[model samples]
Target: MLLLSGCKVKASVWKWLHIAISCFVTAGGLLLLKHSGVVTGGTAGLALSLSPILNIPFHYLFALLNLPFFVFSYFYMGKSFTFTTIIAIAILTGLSSLDSLLPAFTIPELPGAIIGGAFIGIGLIGLFRNGASLGGATILALYLHRKHGINPGKSNFAFDFIVIASSLFAYSLTNGLISVLSIAVTSTVLALLKRKLATVKPGESRAIHPASVN
Candidate 1:
């Protein structure tokens, strides 16, 4: 088990605790990809895509792009959630930078994609359950799920499709295809986990099936 902020914070403390765990877990996944020279999907992938053309590093692009989502989250998910998400994003951004510090290591693309993608999938589920997110596409997907009753998993998959497609133009086709596979694994995990967390309303719990959404 895990303990954070003692018991005084009560239920709200879980949000912060999960946010911290999710940050490191997600960052670890990205770091694995960095070491192996692979890419995944979603807003992080979009940042990777933009990194070359913008001549900006990936972490900076990722952090900057996610800024707009906080506004959307504030109105839809409420102040507490938006604030927690902001802190989570900042922590994740910082943690991901530590990729440079990892000892020289490398792995084949396929295994790297599977392991790295699994880490991200688990981390994202943790964030979703805790009423926080990694921001960017996640924020939009969660807002749509909470407000309009769209299924977050499916919506997130759609966003990943776009992100992966755009990646083809930025990197080799093979790398982009590997990213698609990685995201497919991530989305499948999200779908299964979403069912476990499903609830009928926002501020209730996570999960909504696409067919169930109105």
Candidate 2:
């Protein structure tokens, strides 16, 4: 992980732990997606939609495919974010291989999209709460926020809709539309909660806004 000059390495042990949990959540969120047969948006979602055509499991494909993006983030982003994404990718790969062991768990495409989208949205927000983000379009969204001073919610919404739209080729246009709707509903809920957590609440005891780290 990158550190500020004169900062000791020991300071990051806790951050590392948080990174690990964030990765786990990323994995779990993806697992939910595959089980539900919902085509999610994002690069991983792209990989997922193509997996069946290539006869590859989404998890393994995701791990391998995301490598380039991870490398890009490592160089252009920062060390800590890259480390978290690496762990996140590993966890997701492991989780994806479980299609057999957890063969019985099934979420209809609609419910799957709703629940999985909600979980994934909330998961990303949780990572951001810890002073990082989910590391996909999230990186670009950060860049947009810095470049144009756009709100985080607006940036995320635009990118997420793009991802969700790409699902049309994987599922029929109808199912794809359903998935988009589901993700939209949940993502909006998550964005609101993120803002709520950020601005501080009345009578708050311990506030943990992303800005606190800076």
Candidate 3:
């Protein structure tokens, strides 16, 4: 049990609640970036870039693109981590679908990039701290960190740069530049929180407990 606001909460319940809230925040960030015609990193950014060219919805593309990574996560990150990641992805995908229900609105590109990146970065921290990820580059980044002592922020940024480069074909030069700024913000957040989100040392069998996130 964990004491949250003077109430004792079961760890499992708290973990699931944290996952749901993180997914909602991440999904909201993606929607903001999508409406602003900007992109960040990870599968979300890739999906945004591909949606128009492929004539598909971003949420559907996001879910579809993450499938392969789940296999990788299962083999390397363990069944528990893979399972949590799947649930988190499903929640995010469900929330992202609500974009079609909301009335059209626009967020300024620069502000959206900063705010949306912050939202995503913060949400991702919650997931990673709980032994889960949003799939794609995040899965690989965490894997490398756990196995090789690599810095997740730096590795994640490298992967994001490649994704951003590919996005050039889908966005104008200005929007592409703005997308870079968005990922920079996200990577910076991750870098700053690196210590907090640090995975277990190589060969450690301990699992990340939600109550230990602080």
| Candidate lDDT values, in order | 0.75, 0.62, 0.82
Q: Mind giving the per-residue lDDT tens digits that candidate 2 earns over 28-90?
A: 666777777777666667777888899987776766666677766777656765665566556
Instruction: Report how far off residue 38 is in candidate 3 (Å).
Output: 0.5
Quick one: ranking by TM-score, best first? 3, 1, 2
Better of 1 and 3 by lDDT: 3
- Candidate 3 Cα lDDT to native: 0.82
Put down candidate 1 lDDT per residue, 1-214, tens digits, no spaces.
2466554355455556666887898888887776666766677877766776888877888889887887887878788778778888889888877766768888888888888888888888878776678888888877777668776668887898887786676668888778777777777777777755435344443432335435
- lDDT-wise, the better of 1 and 2 is 1
The true-versus-predicted C-alpha distance at residue 31 of model 1, in Å, is 1.6
- Which one is best on TM-score? 3
TM-score of each: 0.83, 0.73, 0.88
Clashing pairs in 3: none
Over 1-214, each residue of candidate 3 has an lDDT whose tens digit, in order, gives 3357334345566667777887888887888798898978889899988988999998899999999998888888888888889888999988998888999989999999988988898888878876778999999988887788788888988999899998787679899889888888888888898877745532222334556546
User: What's the true lDDT of residue 207 in model 2?
Assistant: 22
TM-score of candidate 2 on Cα atoms, chains taken together? 0.73
| RMSD (CA, Å), each prediction | 6.1, 6.5, 4.0
